[model samples]
Target: MTGVPASAAGGTGRTVPRGKLGTAAVNQASLWNIANILTMVRLVLVPAFVVLLLQDGGHDPVWRAWAWAAFAVAMITDVFDGHLARAYNLVTDFGKIADPIADKAIMAAGLICLSSLGDLPWWVTGVILFRELGITLMRFWVIRHGVIPASRGGKMKTLAQGTAVGMYVLVLTGPLATFRFWVMTVAVVLTVVTGLDYVRQAVVLRRRGLAAERADAAAKAGQRA
Candidate 1:
């Protein structure tokens, strides 16, 4: 999942001055704000998408179209929720956590359903899911050290994956099917390459963070002595 945009204040939120008294009012964003609501909606769509995709034994073009619609809505929300959260300063803890989950949930559901239906290869799903989940865990592993900022290549990977999956969700044939194969190939390549880059960054960040901590502790001991 792409990183949510940083807030206007270079933080998650900000206080705005308001009213005739010109008092500062903290815009305490609630968990139920528009952005978070969109994320929750995407979560709900995951099951609905699966049902639509697998209906009629998972081969009906009309059913697949419906499933694609659900998938499209989920992706559209994925785009807007982050934008809305950043633009309106509606970022919240629930949003921060739920947004990425919503992104991966819908995409995973799409990929798995397609694979289960024998449309896409299971290995493709495995590679993409492994990279996405691994990077997520790696982020947490080094979170105390520092955030691994999203790179251009990482954004490209997300785009490639989304486009490839969306194409697979549709019941395309002939030339279109051939084209999507190549698209998915590109997506898989990006997934593996970017995942390796993230691992390298996590190692460097953790080492640096640990060294800084040690230096601080040594200085504190000297001060006490």
Candidate 2:
């Protein structure tokens, strides 16, 4: 009927509870959001990239370059997804949790593969992978208290690693071999610096008792309320 609200309609033309449609709309919005979808896409690409890298044909310089290019694209998606989420106010808990995991997995797998192929030094990969895993575990440990936001140094570390790995792959070409080594060396230095910075931040947080202090303050305010 012309008088019926848009949310209500049926064969019998009966009116439904208005709140149901509103809740459904909210649920649908939450489920199909851009940020969460991008996170899932990133996670899916990790395994595909790994498979491509592991295949025997992947040893060819051309194939390796393509694989690395695919990886770089995936990594770029990681950057853009976060930027879009924050810039457009599309952030979600799903994104926050999955994005870092996807990043660590992709980078770790790539490094491991490169190491196995004897293309990169194991020690360098080991140091970076260990730091990534350690920080990820720390995030889980502190997640109950609150999120530790990504620091500027941490972001720079990611950029450095990506650039280094990309250059390393490009260096597979005979002409660029020496340049790749230098790029990788720079990346390794950045990785160590950023890792230490994260450790320092954790120590500062503990010393200030920021999370506990905030919790206590919240409780006291609640009591007063």
Candidate 3:
């Protein structure tokens, strides 16, 4: 089997197995990789998106369209960055932490801006943001145990939210407005349900992690005796 050459292993004059080296390389993926760059682009777009969104009293269709463009770019990048990271083994600690923060930042900015403009009710924003913030905290809470891979339900929730928020960002009227309201409703429901599911997963993960630590400790003690 192919292996990492000695020169690539700190010039130690010893080759390393390909499997182990590949795993280590992935774990140490550079911060400057395409995945992390896309994530940073999303982060940069948030402020620009907000500026476009709130421009001209937040009612002009033209400016709203621009804001929606920015938002769309941000959301599109969100999908690609994660896919690229996982597919190409470009996942890094920075990507793991920043991707979610960028996701929440863009969405939170859009929601707060819409609420402030009286376009969306504050209660809806409150509900979605609360769930988002709670889930994020829960991720950090169990982070020491392991990373939580995004579930199918979580992907659905994100799609629902992006669609709903995108619609709201536009100057829809009459029937379209009503449709958006329903979409937002679904998004909100998904948000709550997925949040609860994540909480359950976090609890289970922490429990297992703790149990494993205890088992390791016992094994070490037995070995010593």
Whole-model lDDT values for every prediction: 0.88, 0.76, 0.94
RMSD of each candidate?
Answer: 9.0, 4.3, 4.6
Candidates in order, TM-scores: namely 0.86, 0.79, 0.83
Better lDDT candidate (1, 2): 1
Give candidate 1 misplaced runs (Cα > 4 Å). 1-29
Q: 2 or 3: which has the higher TM-score?
A: 3
TM-score of candidate 2 against the unseen true structure: 0.79
The Cα RMSD in angstroms, rounded to one decimal, for candidate 2 relative to the true structure is: 4.3
- In model 3, which regions exceed 4 Å deviation? 1-29
Per-residue lDDT, model 2, residue 195, is 76
- Model 1 clash pairs are none
Error of 3 at 164 (Å): 0.5
Question: What is the per-residue lDDT of model 2 for residues 68-102, given as tens digits with 9 covering 90 to 100?
Answer: 87788778888888888888877767777788888
lDDT of 3 at 14: 90
- For all candidates, the clash counts are 0, 0, 0
**After aligning candidate 1 to the native by TM-score, how far in Å is the CA of 21 from where it should be?**
17
Clashes of 1: 0
Which residue pairs show collisions in model 3?
none
lDDT of 3 by residue, 1-225 (tens): 577779988799998988898877766658789999999999999999999999999999999999999999999999999999889888888998899899999999999999999999999999999998988888889999998888999999999999999999999999999999999999999999998999999999999999999999999999999
